[model samples]
Target: MTVRLRPHHLLCLLTYIGKGYSPAFIAGLTEIARRVNAGEEVVIVTGPDDICAPLLEDPDAHCHNPGVQIRDANAARDVGALLDRDIRHGLRMVLTPVLVAQMRAAFANQDTRSACARCDWAALCSDIAADGFVGAILQAQDSTAE
Candidate 1:
């Protein structure tokens, strides 16, 4: 079974180090990070109801079974859709110079408020983005290094 990951998932994989969310969520994210670090292609589904639903409903997965609200799910789906669109347009890999720039621009743009407003790590993430994403990526990599 494949998991359709979003830009938020990419952000989490890059910055999360055993903080926020459940342990299961952290572990799942870590696994995804491992795949990303290994240069794996993270597939992303296109529709709102396709991938986010199962992720929200599964206990051993992203949501820990409590089931995410519609708003949250929609937000995640929208972020994923944006990431997928960027990827299709030659953003071949996540964390590349172009992709990072795109992510930073998306976060900084006022129009994308819904993407970050609901995030628990928004303040810190915004600070990280503002300060420079390379450091944040390295910090996350170092923190997760085995």
Candidate 2:
């Protein structure tokens, strides 16, 4: 099955190495990640707030806590649009090496501090990027490229 790929999803896949999010959300995201690693054709979904708001509203969801402020809706939309454009016109796939490289470049080009201000994993993500932990993210490769 094709999964809807979003910028937040890509960021989570890159930086989330351990416990976070509700179990149900984690399970669902894990399945999506698996499909992505298997070279599945992902449909870019730029509306993260729409897709995630309900999930985050669940009391069991990790993001439901008061301390975790939701990301700015406009910024999320902008980032998602950028990623969608890059995936469709630039990379053609959501989880390919080329896509990853392009994403890293995009991150480099922007002041991610503001973009990631609401993310709980932002500090950890910055460390991962500083440490050049691309391998940690790329290890999701589970299928031969189609």
Q: Could you say which candidate leads in lDDT?
A: 2
Q: Taking the candidates one at a time, how many backbone clashes does each contain?
A: 0, 0
- The list of candidate 1 runs beyond 4 A from truth reads 1-3, 6-18, 46-97, 108-111, 134-146
- Candidate 1, residues 1-146, lDDT tens digits: the string is 33455434444444444444556555665565555555555554333322244356556554432223333444455555657554321123544444544544565553344645556687866665565554443122232345
lDDT of every model, 2 decimals: 0.47, 0.52
Model 2 misplaced regions, further than 4 Å = 46-92, 108-113, 139-146
* TM-score of model 1 vs. true structure: 0.50
TM-score list, all predictions: 0.50, 0.58
Q: What is the C-alpha RMSD of each candidate to the true structure, in Å?
A: 7.3, 6.2
Between which residue pairs do clashes occur in model 1?
none
The ten-residue window of minimal lDDT in model 1 covers: 136-145
